[model samples]
Target: MSLKILITGAAGFIGSNLCEYFVSMGHDVLGLDNLSTGSLSNIEGLRLKDNFNFLKGDIRDIETCRKAVLNRDYVLHQAALGSVPRSINDPITSNDVNVGGFLNMLVACKDAGVKKMVYAASSSTYGDSKALPKVEERIGKPLSPYAITKYVNELYADVFYKTYGLNTIGLRYFNVFGRRQDPNGAYAAVIPLFTKQLMNKQSPTINGDGTYSRDFTYIDNVIQANEKAMLTVHPEAVNSIFNIAYGERTDLKMLVDLLKMSLSKYDKSILNIEVIYGPVREGDVPHSLASIDKAKRILNYQPQFNLRDGLDEAVDWYWSHL
Candidate 1:
């Protein structure tokens, strides 16, 4: 059956991808974006679809959030200020958007009686924990302001379920990257940023000798997690947090090598591009890997793309678009 869905950050890379996927599946998708970091170009394709509608609004405003949630069957809340560096530089603004805005969305969803909300939680919530293959049950203290905001999201979602009877699921995304991700922003994700630079034959900088690693999940895997979280009928899956990842770690050096090898298919010159070493970034974890057992057992999430496959697809998109 078709449903009415509201995607809070519909103009962003992940949110726009969600809008397109849901719209393609014949759902009535209402996209609300403040355009602070999200670009309209990302969702331009969806604008032409009859099943899609977009509202230019900020999540910080209660009225805007309420308006967006009203009559919506489900809410996929993806609006938040991302990037550790960005949050470190502007903690106040990040707090307002990530923490304040998220609270507003939860209230709106509860008051409007939305069936469920699947929000974009961050892996940064595992901060300072030296554990490998992070499990859903254990988490360490957050290292950055951005991490704190995302951790708070989980707390709020849990309380909403326990107190107000709102059904909510949180997916802790690990280093998500793929097509439509912005490679030009100052705080751009590593994959897209490195891919763009390598394609242009420029030396991309790798912080701290490039030994730091990440789970590096693909965008499709994230989309799959969101869909499963939103539509699943499994009683055990609702109102809990799950790690959405490919369950494998790749170091920065290996990541650059893979990107070069992938892009070299289009232009062999990229293989020879060198990387510059720099100081380690603040708030960066040494390594990150996830135990996707909870998500798989509950949500039936089966990621189709691994690191190499995802990189190839992402490289192709960036080569054509950038």
Candidate 2:
């Protein structure tokens, strides 16, 4: 059955992919974006679908949010200021957009009586914990403004679910990277950044001796989690948070090597590129891995792509676009 779906930040990497997935599946998609960090090009491809509609606006405004939420069945809230370094540079903007804007959307959704709300949470919520595989039940103090904003989203979601009977699910994403992830920004993720450099035969920078590790998730896995969270009829699954990541870890050094190897298939010059190391940026977690057992047990979530396969696809995308 096709349903009306409203996606905030629908021009962003993850959000745009979600819009594409739902629109392709025959859902009526209303894509709202301010294009702050997002690009109109992201959703321009979706215009070919008759069921898709695009709205240009910011989530920080209550009226804009209300207009987008009215009569919407499910709201996939993905708008926010991302990047820890960027947050450190400008915490106020981060708080305003990620926290204040998030609250505005929540209020609008509650008022609209939307059936369910699924949002993009972050692994930065795990903060300074030394745990190898982060679990939802245990979380440490947030180290950065970005982390704080994401944690607050989860808290507010819980309160809305309790106070207004609004169903909400938060997916704490961990280094989600794949096609359409922008590579031009100074704060771009390692995969897209490196893929661009390698394709151009330039050395990629490896922050903090390349030992910093992450459970880099593919976009398809996140899309699967969102779809299941929005469509699942299981009552036990509503109003909770799930770690949306593959249960595997890859260090930055290994990731650079893999990128080179993957790109080598298309361009031989990529194999000769050397990785340069730099001091770690402030607010960066040394290591992160996610426990997906909760999502697996409840949402029946299964990750179809791992690091290597995901890297191959991501490199291919940058190769084509760049």
Candidate 3:
């Protein structure tokens, strides 16, 4: 059945994609974004659709949050200031947007009597743990302010459910990358950054000897997780957290080689480009891999695209932008 949904950060990389998916499925989507980090170009393609509505606002404002949540069947809260390095530089802004704003959304949702609230959490919350595949039950210390914010989100989410009986689900995203992930900014993710550099015949930057690994989930996988979480019939799945990642790992070195190989077919200059290695940034994890058994069991979450396919699509998008 089609539902009335409110998607915060709907102009963002993942949020925009979610809007498109839901609109195509004949659902009514109300998208709220302040244009901070999100661009209108990302959602412009959807504004012409009759089922999609766009509202420019910040989640930090409780009134705005309350207004957006009114009569919404489900709330997909994707508005957050991502990136560990950005958080490390300005923790207060990150805290206000990620933690403070998240709290506001939860309270607003509870008051508005929304059916369910599914939010975007981060895998960085599993900081410093050496577990091969991270489970939701086991977590280590938060290494960065960003990780702390995400962990705190889970805490607040649980508390809200316990205190007010608000149905909430947190999907912990790991290294999500794909089309519309901004590649020109200083805070761009490795995949988009590397893709852009390769397309432009420029060197890509790698840190810490290119040995650092990540789960490297795709955009489609994240969207599927969100869709499943929002529509799951199991009562146990509600008011819980799940990892939204493909259960695999890829190191930086391998990623660079893959990007060059893919780009070389169209542009030979990419093959001669060298990746520059530098100091590892603070608050960055060395390796990250997620166990999706819990998500599979609960939400029936299955990732449709792996890293190679995701990278191919990402690079192709960059090629178009260039």
lDDT of candidate 3 over 198-311, digit per residue (tens) = 787778889889999999998999999999999998978988999989999999999998888777777887888888998998988899999999999989998989888888
How many backbone overlaps does candidate 2 show? 0
TM-scores, in order shown?
0.99, 0.99, 0.98
Better of 1 and 3 by lDDT: 1
Give one clash count per candidate, in the order shown: 0, 0, 0
Candidate with best lDDT: 1
Q: Relative to the unseen true structure, what is the C-alpha lDDT of residue 258 in candidate 1, on a scale of 0 to 100?
A: 94
Query: Between prediction 1 and prediction 3, which has the larger TM-score?
Result: 1
- Model 3 TM-score, 2 decimals: 0.98
Model 2 weakest 10-residue run by lDDT:
267-276
Stretches > 4 Å off in candidate 1 = none
How would you order the candidates by lDDT, starting with the best?
A: 1, 2, 3
36-150: candidate 2 lDDT, tens digit per residue: 9999898888988899999999988999999999899999999998999999999999999999999999999999999999999999999999998999889999999999999
Residue 260 displacement (Å), model 3: 1.4
Per-residue C-alpha lDDT of model 1 across residues 1-322, encoded as one tens digit per residue: 8999999889999999999999999999999999999999999988999999999999999999999998999999999999999999999999999999999999999999999999999999999999899998899999999999999999999999999999999999999999999998799999998888887789999999899999999999999999999989999987899999999999999999999899888998888998999999999989999999999999999999999999989988988899
